[model samples]
Target chain A: MKKHNYSAGPCILPQEVFEKSAQAILNFNNSGLSILEISHRSKDFVAVMDEARALALELLGLEGKGYQALFLHGGASLEFLMIPYNLMKVEGKAAYLDTGTWANSAIKEAKHFGETVVVASSKAENYNHIPKGYVVPSDADYFHCTSNNTIFGTQMKEFPSLEIPMVCDMSSDIFSRTLDFSKFDLIYAGAQKNMGPAGTTLVVVKEEILGKSGRNIPNMLDYVQHIEKESMYNTPAVFPVYASLLTLQWLKNLGGIAAIEKVNEAKANLLYTEIDRNPLFKGAAVAEFRSNMNATFLLNDETHAPIFDKLWKEAGISGLPGHRSVGGYRASMYNALPLESVQVLVDVMKELESKI
Target chain B: MKKHNYSAGPCILPQEVFEKSAQAILNFNNSGLSILEISHRSKDFVAVMDEARALALELLGLEGKGYQALFLHGGASLEFLMIPYNLMKVEGKAAYLDTGTWANSAIKEAKHFGETVVVASSKAENYNHIPKGYVVPSDADYFHCTSNNTIFGTQMKEFPSLEIPMVCDMSSDIFSRTLDFSKFDLIYAGAQKNMGPAGTTLVVVKEEILGKSGRNIPNMLDYVQHIEKESMYNTPAVFPVYASLLTLQWLKNLGGIAAIEKVNEAKANLLYTEIDRNPLFKGAAVAEFRSNMNATFLLNDETHAPIFDKLWKEAGISGLPGHRSVGGYRASMYNALPLESVQVLVDVMKELESKI
Candidate 1:
């Protein structure tokens, strides 16, 4: 049976990337050394780091624009704290939009460093929609928002053009679509979603926005120090970074983010159309705020839940189970997820509907 | 052409561990999903985490001893700061022994959190010997030391029985030998030299020693929080942790630290004996403090450098070059390195001597 991976994170990567990464584990660049054992400072792994950083900026259309890209360990969860630690000052206030779990977590961490104002929140609606028409405080040092909510499957369609610097956590939706790169001062993503593996976090920061925090940032968490050391300030997540480099190469070869966004749109539209048209299920998020990356839905007839789950599982679907906080199905269609997998899911839904 | 890997970290792992890890990256547990794509919360990876933690504690003879083992990201460098952040209070002082590079780095980070006193240092000798007979201040919150200096090639053969808590950085020599586990309140090691890879760090902390800092530690850096979450406080360096698990399994199957220590001693003795007898080479560290993990040596005649280098290269040796701070050869014979590799290196030395 052909397995369809719809895992939320540490999720899906291109098959070629997996194969290449596996081969590298055996012998990296024919160095007769496993990628697992090679030094990050070695010329072979250095090229991997350089290419990964370059490709991230290139895909975001921010190359040579004073934006530095770094692949660091500790996932996005750590970034939640590191961002505020390095960017938020003791007296300054940063504005955050609480869309879902990750954004709320970010806001919580930012509060430890400085005053954090929740500019907008959709918590009242169980985070089923993206908040809009929120006011950004002029006194705020920066306006932070999560571009995509992986749990509730709500995505911000239009970002607010703020006078203050903008920081975005694009963990789930990064590189899945093309966005204006010049708008945000800092952007970070955990690589498990649209990128590669789970270990390394991708941080893209505008160099000019840093050094204004006026606080002593720890060396490992300091953006300026990491940039100065070229992300080799310490031994990075070498295997994950190398896997990310391969994925970026695949993305570049397929014509970068612009080209992938079309496929992503088609995949999301395919499943969402099924959810809307089929009487058995309904979309989790509002139609207007629906995420093209993570399409979440719930069955209309709760009694048929077991049947639907069995249908999908028999069809070789994996990681389609929704988060415990949101009890429903979530099909994460990352950059590596193919249209065929989405069709398989859509077909399973159609089969369940017809049987009913 | 067999390769003799002697790289200091991101260093050699057992060939079987490498093979299994590579296979898992392709299809983990026959689940039709790559280990790279599985969620940390998934049962498979959770098992990996649990087994790794259990095996670490079991090997250390600290199982059920009120200690916690965590596999975290950001390397030992991050732990350098985390140690102080979670242990050092605002007005409290911590005592340290400045042995070499990593220990000094740890001291530097400790100073950021609280008053750090260097109880002893061998900096005057360029760290060629481990300082002995230094009394740790009774007023100090804890006593910290580096068990082995990777760059300086010095190892502390005996640990001080301190009245206060003892913290040791065993990055280069962890699991390579058996030690009295109850003597230290905390031990941290980067998983590159003897353990596994470079990204993940191993932290074993006594539960009772935590919460003494009386400072608000950041969520990610807090030992209590991570312990509560079983080190899944973040997404973790999943790949590295999984690799570390496999390596731990390999170590356990080979009869754990006690068995490996014999092999390590033999390999170190084989190389050190050659370095002493071979006129072409001279050992760098004082014989009393010379490391069994990293054997640092220099050529007797600077003129023979090129020839000696060529001979080693021709014999398929890797990572034998010394750090720039100490201009000599450093053959790091971690647990994974077989005695055969040391014999090959010793043979290369003899060949160079014959040519001379």
Candidate 2:
């Protein structure tokens, strides 16, 4: 039975990626050795790391720009510290928009470095929408924001332009939509959502924005050192990088973000239409700021959950339960998630309405 | 042809580990979901994380000994910075034994925290032997050393008794020998050598040694935070941890380190004895401190290099070249390398002498 895995992270990837990853583990590039055993510095694996980094920049349309893409260890959580370490000056402040849980966490880590100013926050309203009219301070070292919130199913539809360096955590929505990626000085995403698996984080940083922090940054967290080493300053996450290359290759073959954006819009539209039309269900986030990658919805009455859950399980749907903080169902429609799966989920939702 | 892999660090693991890991990537535990696609918070993956952590402690005989084992990212290189951040006080010093490239790197990172004392160093001797008769400062916050030097083919046979905390970077040789594992307050190993693949790192620390640094440790670099979250403080390297679990299970089934230690010694002795008996080759490191896991050697006559390289290639050996600083050959015989592979290499060495 095929499963519609809607896991928020460490989430679904293309079937070809799983097959190729398994083959590499058994025998990498027909090299008579498992990919797991090969030296990272070897020519074969070095090519892999090189291709992964190059393809990431190519996909973002940041090629030939000042950006250097790095496949680093420690997920976006570590990036929270690295951003402050590599960007914020000694006693300087960073401006952040608090839109969701991840954005809030980033703000918390940034506060530990120096002064952190929250320009505006949607947290008081349970993060159901992207905050508007947020004024990023001009004198701040940088402005940070989360592009998509997986937990609350909200996404920033329009980013605020700033004179200061702009950084964004696109962990859930990177490569799902087309945007002028060059506008942001530093953009990072964890690989589990819409990229590959859980292990490596993709960091795209413009070279001109680094080394101005005026602090004694450690080697591992310093972006300049990683860029200098070509993401091999130390041993990188080899398997994750290889798998991500396979994914980026998959995305490129599928005609890049421009082509995938149409399909994403179709999936989101199909699911959201049912949520609004059905008397039993209602969308969780505000309609204007709803995420295309993850759709959070709640039943009008909680009593129907058992039957709805049973129907989805029978329909082979997994990871439908929302975050514990938000008690509902979340259907994550990452790039690899097919529209047919969303159709199946919509059919199940319709059936729940009919049965009730 | 079955190639004999000799790459250091990201070296060979058991064949069963490769097979099982590949199977899991395709269909994990008959769960009908690829392990790469599952959430870290899922019941299945949480079980894997628990098992891997528990088995690491169990194999090291540290169970119920106030020790906590964690799987982290950024490899041993990151642990260098983490050790200084979490152990060294704001202004106090730490003692270090400079053994090899990795140890020197650790010492470099420790210097960023406070005073770093090089108690003794074999760097003057080209790191050919572990320094002895060094005194660790009693007032230092901790003492640090590398258990085995893969690049230099040296192993510390004895560790000093310390009043302060003791930390060991056992990256290349963990789970290969039996040791008084509880003697060290903290031990970290990158999981690519004897453990599994290149993504997650294994950190085992005695609980009582933490929270004494008095520095504001970032959440990601804090061992206490990771322990409190059970290694899921952030999204862990899922595929690496699962693969490591497979390798750990294989080691346990093979009778743990005691059984593997005998085999390791036999393999090392077989190769080293032939290197000694054969006039064409000479061991690189001092006799007393030669490592059993990685045996670095050189050709006595440089003119025989072509034939020696050809013979080893014909015998299906790979990753034979030594570190660039040490121009020679290194045979890395980790826990999963079969004894028959060593026999094949020894046969090739014998063939080289006859042909010459």
Candidate 3:
């Protein structure tokens, strides 16, 4: 059966990128070696390195902006520690917007090193919306927020212009839209979601923001080490970085994030409109803070829960389950999720309505 | 033109495994979802988890030995910090046998948390051999050594008998042969060199090794946290781990370590004999300490180096350059390298002799 992938992370990718990536794994740009087996130091792979880093900057439109793009090992969870380690020298106090699990996780990791203030939390309303109107601690070194919450299906559609160094965890919605990345001092995303695969994390940091941390960070933990080595301080995950490059090229070929954003808005509106029009299902997140990436919803009756699941699975759609923290149904509409896949989910919802 | 892969780690795998890994990447096990897009928590992926872990233990022949095998995200470099964070709580010093660069790196990380003793070091002779006959520190908590030196092509043929824990950085040579694994409390290898790819690391730790260290490790950095979560602590490098599973399964189908060892030794012997017997080239390391996985050799005259490089490039043999540290030639004889390829390298050596 033909299938559509809606997994939140480690999710769907374009067929062109997969074919291109597989070829590289086999022959690596006609160099007659597997990308998996090649040294990141090799000339062929250096081109891959340069391409991956450049494409990230190109996609974000941050050339000549004093921002350095780094591809490093460890997921965003590791970055949770590193961001604090690299930036904590001036961070006597930091304001963290506790939007959901990932933001909370970041806040927890940061507090181990120094003082962190939770300015606003969405947990009171069950994280259905982005926490807003939090008093910005003007004295803090930087303010941190997650741009997109993968599980909760909430997003910070707009960021506060605090003017201080700003950090954003764009794990879910990076490359899904065009934005002024120059406004944020640092931004990172795990590759598993919108980027490429799960092995590497993409970090775009302003060079000046570094060297301010008073702590004696390990060479590996320091962003400057990777920056100096060009992310080749140690052997990198070459294949995943190559895959990221291919995906970025594809995104660029598809007219970059601006073009993708329009299509994304269409897909999200279709799904959201359908959910709002039907009584059998209800949007799990608050309307104003809804995520264009993830559409979380539930059935009118508990009896139809499994039925809805069976309906979608039979229709050749998968990975639409919601989080256990807020269990129901979650249709993750990440970048590269074809509009047809969302239509498939909407069709299932419509079919259930007819049966009722 | 035919090509051979000699780039270490993510190095090379059989063509069959690549084909299979690719199909799964497109859609996993007929589950109607790409392997990349599936949830690590889904039952479909849980089977991948069980198979890869079970195969790792089975390959080591450590069945029912009260040890748990884990597949994790970061490379062995992270383990340099993680190992001490997990096991260094005992105030007693740990013995480090410095074989090469990676070995010393681990030693540097261990010093941050507890007392460490450099029991042995081969750096005096330029890391030409694994150092031996150092007194095992009576107050030591554990003994750590790198199993195989990638750059120098030297390996520890045997481990010193000790009462304390035996920990190893087996990044370059795990599952190369059947070994007395019970001698070690923990062993970790990055997936690039001998495992599958560079995105994941394989760590096997004795279950009882935990809790002895009184240090507080960050949740992600702690081995116990991963063990408790069954290696599903977060979204894993899903495709790499899955690809590694196929490689591990491939290892088993080739009759486990014993069978592969016989073939691997044959490949290494052919290439080394050629390196020593031919006048056009000379071996880099001492014969007794040479690595079976990576064979380092040099041209008899430095003037012919570029010629030899061009000859191999035209012959479709790739990654033949030796490490800058050991400037000559290194023919990595990995498990996936066919005996025929080694013969090709020997043939080139013979041809070089005639040309010179």
Interface RMSD of each: 1.1, 0.7, 1.8
Docking class of 3: medium
Ranking by lDDT: 2, 1, 3
Give the winner by DockQ. Answer: 2
lDDT by residue (tens digit), candidate 1, B1-356: 78999888889999988899899989999999899988889999999999999999999999999999999888898988898888887799999999998888899888888789998899889899998889999988899999999998999999999889999999999998889988999999999887887779999999999998888777888899999999898788888898999899999999999999999999999999998898778999999999999999998789999998998999989999999989889999999999999999999999988888
Question: Which model, 1 or 3, shows the larger TM-score?
Answer: 1
Q: What is the per-residue lDDT of model 3 for residues B7-122, given as tens digits with 9 covering 90 to 100? A: 76557787777788778766678775667667777888899888899889989987799788999876888888788878876575787889898998888878876787888898
lDDT of 1 by residue, A32-84 (tens): 99998877778888988998998899889999898999998788877888888
Per-residue C-alpha lDDT of model 2 across residues B74-180, encoded as one tens digit per residue? 99999999999999999889999999999999998888888999999999889999988988989999999999999999999999988899999999999999999
Clashing pairs in 2: none
Candidate 1 backbone collisions, by pair: B191-B197
For residue B259, give model 2's deviation from the true position in Å: 0.5
Docking class of 2: high
TM-score of 2: 0.99
Docking class of 1: medium
What are the chain A TM-scores of the candidates, in order? 0.99, 0.99, 0.98
Candidate 3: residue B321 Cα off by (Å): 1.2
The C-alpha local distance difference test score for the whole of candidate 2 amounts to 0.94
